[model samples]
Target: MIVVTTPTGQIGSQLVHRLLDQDKEVRVIVRDASRLEDTVRERVETVEGSHDEPGVLDEALPGAEALFWLVPPSRQAPSVREYYLGFARVGAAAVARHGVGHVVGVSSAGHGWPTPAGVLSAAFAMDAELGASGAAYRALSMPFYMENLLGQLDAIRGPGAFHLTCAGDLPLASIATRDIAGVAADLLTDLSWTGQRNLPVFGPDRLTPDGMAEVISQELGRPVTYRRMSMDDYASLLRSRGAGDQQVKDMTEAFAAQDHGIYDADWATAEPTSTDFRTWCREVLRPAADA
Candidate 1:
C-alpha cells in the first residue's frame, strides 16, 4: 500500500488517479472525505484527519510500502517555514517508525540560495529530514507551476493577460503539475533507485511571462499580454483576494527573490522536459478559460 497525502488537491488527486491506474494498492489521508469523489473513497483506504497531527501517520503509514508527501498550502499559517517543518518532523518520525522504504515528496528548486526562499525553504528542510531517515527518497524538485496561472483565470479572460511582479522578459523555470504527478507516480511505483536525490522537473521550454503570454495568445487565437505589476500592488491584490497576513509576507518575499533573479539558475540546470507552456495552455488553460 502507498499512502498519499493531500488526496483532494490538484497534484495529489492526479497522483492518486495515476497510481490507481497502475493498479497499486492506495491509501489516502484527507481531512474531509466529502471532498473526494465516491470512486476514490471507495477504492482507497481512507483516514480522515490532518496529516500533520502526531498520530495521524501511525494509523496511515503502517503496512504502506511507499509514501507520497506534499505539504498543502496553509493561508493562515503563522510562519510558513515553521508550519512546514512541524509537519515534516512528524512525517519523518512516522516514516522511521513504520520502516517505509521509499518516499516521493513534492519539493522545489533553489536548494541553498543566499536569499529568503519563502515557503520553498520548507521543502528543502523536509527533504533533508526525510533523506536522513534512510528511506529511498526522491525529492521531486519543480519550479513555479504553470497551473498557478489558473488562479488568475479571471485576469486572463478579462484583461487578456497574466500578471506578475517579476520581469516579464526574463525567462524562468516552470512545470506542469500533471508532469510532476506523472513522474512522482512512476517513482513511487518502483523501488529501483535507492538513497536520496533531487529530480528536476522543469517543463520543456524556458519561457518568460511575456513569452508565455505570446504562446497563450497564439493558442487561444487572441491577444494576451504579461503585465508586470509593482510589488506593493501585487501584495495589495493578494490581500484583496482574502490572503492572510503571513501569506502576504511570504509572497512578498517570494516576489522579491524573483525580482532579484534568484530562480534564474533553475533554468540553467533544468531537467529533461515534456510539456511546455504552449501545450499546457492548449491542454489545461484553454479549457479553464472556456469554463
Candidate 2:
C-alpha cells in the first residue's frame, strides 16, 4: 500500500490519480474528503484528518510500502520553522513505528546553501527530519512554480502588469507542479530504490519575470509588463491580501533569497521537461484568462 499526504492539494490530488492509473493500492490522509474529485473519492482509502497528527499517521502508515508527503502551508501557523519540523518529527516517528520503507516528498532546490530563507529553509529542515528516520527518501526538489502566475491574472487583466519581488532581468529557475507530480508518481509505484536523494525538477528553460511577461504578451496577444516590488512592499501587499505576520515574513524572505541566488549551481541535465514558459502560458494561463 502507498499513502499520500495533502491529497487534495495541487500536486497530491494529481499524484493520487496517477497512482490509481498504475493500479497501486492508494490511501490518502486529508482534512476534507469533499474537496476531492468525485472520481477520486470513490477509489482511494480515506483517513480523515490532518496527516501531521500522530494518531492519523499511525493509522495511515500500517501496511504501507511507500509514502508521498507534503507540508501544506498555513497563514495562521504560529512559527513556520516549528510547523515544518513539527510535522516532520511526527511523520518520522510514525514511519519507524509502521515500518514503511520508501518516502517521496515535496521540497525545493538549494538544499545545502547557507541561510536559506523562509519556505526554502523550512523545506530543507523538513527533509532532514524525514531523512533522520530509517526510510529511504527522495525529496522532489522544485523551483518557483509556473502556476504562481495564475494568481496574478486579475492584476494583468486590470492594470496590464503583474508583480514579483525578484529583479526583472535575473533568470529564475521554474517548474510546473504537473511535471513534479508526474515524476513522483513514477517513483512511488516502483518502490525499488533505497537511500535518500534529491531530484532537481527544473523545467526546460530559465526565464525572468520580464521574460515571462514577454511570453505572456506573445501568447495572449496583449501588452503586459513585469512590476518589480521591493521586499517590504511585497510584504505589505501580502498583508493587505490577508496573509498573517508569519506568512508575510516567510514569503518576503523567500523572494529576497531568490533575487540573490535561488540555486547554487547550473543544472545541465539531459532531456529536461518540455513544458516551457510559452507552452504553459498558451495552454494553462490562456484558459484561466478566458474563464
Residue 115 of model 2: what lDDT? 69
lDDT of 2 by residue, 1-291 (tens): 999999888899889989999888999999988988889889999999997899999889999999999999877786688899999999999998999999998998877877648888899899999997999999988888999988899988778898888888988788888888898998998888999987778888778889999999998889999989888888787889888888887877787777777663524442367688889888899899889
lDDT of 1 by residue, 119-205 (tens): 776678888988887788988888889999998888888889888887888886788999999998888888799988888778888
Model 1 lDDT, residue 28, Cα: 98
Q: What is the lDDT of residue 139 in candidate 1?
A: 88
Pairs with backbone N, CA or C atoms under 3 Å apart (clashes), candidate 1: none
> For candidate 1, what is the lDDT?
0.86
Provide C-alpha RMSD values for all models, in order: 1.6, 1.6
lDDT of each: 0.86, 0.86
- How does candidate 2 score on lDDT? 0.86
Off by over 4 Å in 2: 242-246, 266-271
